[model samples]
Target: MNSFLTSGLIHAAFWVVVGLTFGGAVLAVFPRKIVYNVLGLIVCLSGVAGLFLYLGSFFLALMQLLIYVGAICVAIVFAIMLSPPLHLEVPKRRMGKVVLSAGASGVFFVAIAAVIWKTVWHPAAERGADWSIVTIGHLLLTRYDLVFELISLVLLVAIIGAILTTGFSRRLSS
Candidate 1:
């Protein structure tokens, strides 16, 4: 009975996290306010971290929280703060553009669904028991070094761009 209850609780929690993730994504995209978008992104990232925790990857969960939610979101918020307040009226979206975007999205969704339907997913024959932080760190530094460095570079460039843009906007406003 206890095991069944625990399983039921875990299942419910998983769905809740999924719901949070989807809701946050919608909130992030649909809102006109940048602040609300950032808040939604934070919520979405937090939900992803929770999903990672449920997957038994504590290290991944921590990294998701620390890097994405902690660093990126804070940086975005800072960028918004440094920029001048946007008081310009938003232009109305054209119906043609909306239809085009919707059609493109539909095509992409169909393609992805077809791929998923055709793919045969097989579980690993032998699962590795070494999910330790040290193993992951070593793998990241050794095997995935280039990818890791590229990600770092991208983040650095983004931060620099944000600062430069803010500076230029301030100068222009002055």
Candidate 2:
């Protein structure tokens, strides 16, 4: 009885997380205000992190929350706050442009979906049973040093760019 109840609860939680993810995605894209958009992105990323947890990849979930929800979303919010046009409304777009963009996106989506469906995904024949966090970290630092350094550089540049823009705006205003 207890096992059944636990399973049922887990299923319910999974649906809730999925709903939050899609709802947040809709909220992120549909909002006209920058603040709302940022908030929605945070919510969506949080939902994605929760979904990752459900998939049994605890490390990935933690990274998703840390890198995407915590770091990137906070940085985006900071950038929006630093900008002077917080109160300015977004300009309306023409219907033709909107339709063209939607059509292009649809085509891209279809092509990607076709590729995904056509691809034959096979797991590696030799599987290592060791899944320790420490090992993962060591591998990242040793084998993927260049990729890690690149990611860090990109993040640093983004932060610097945000700071420069804010400083420039402040100087102009003064």
TM-score for each predicted model, relative to the true structure: 0.56, 0.61
Q: Which portions of model 2 miss their true places by more than 4 Å? A: 86-138, 141-161
lDDT of 2 by residue, 23-65 (tens): 8898899989878888889889999999999999787898899
| lDDT, candidate 1, 37-147, per-residue tens | 999999999999999999988878988997899789988898878767778433457899899999999999999999999998765445644757868867887999999
lDDT (C-alpha) at residue 110 in model 1? 100
Pairs of colliding residues, candidate 1: none
**Model 1 lDDT-worst window of ten:** 122-131
**Candidate 1 global lDDT:** 0.86
Tell me the number of clashing residue pairs for each predicted model.
0, 0
Superposed by TM-score, candidate 2 places the C-alpha of residue 71 at a distance from the truth, in angstroms, of 2.0
Candidate that scores best on TM-score: 2
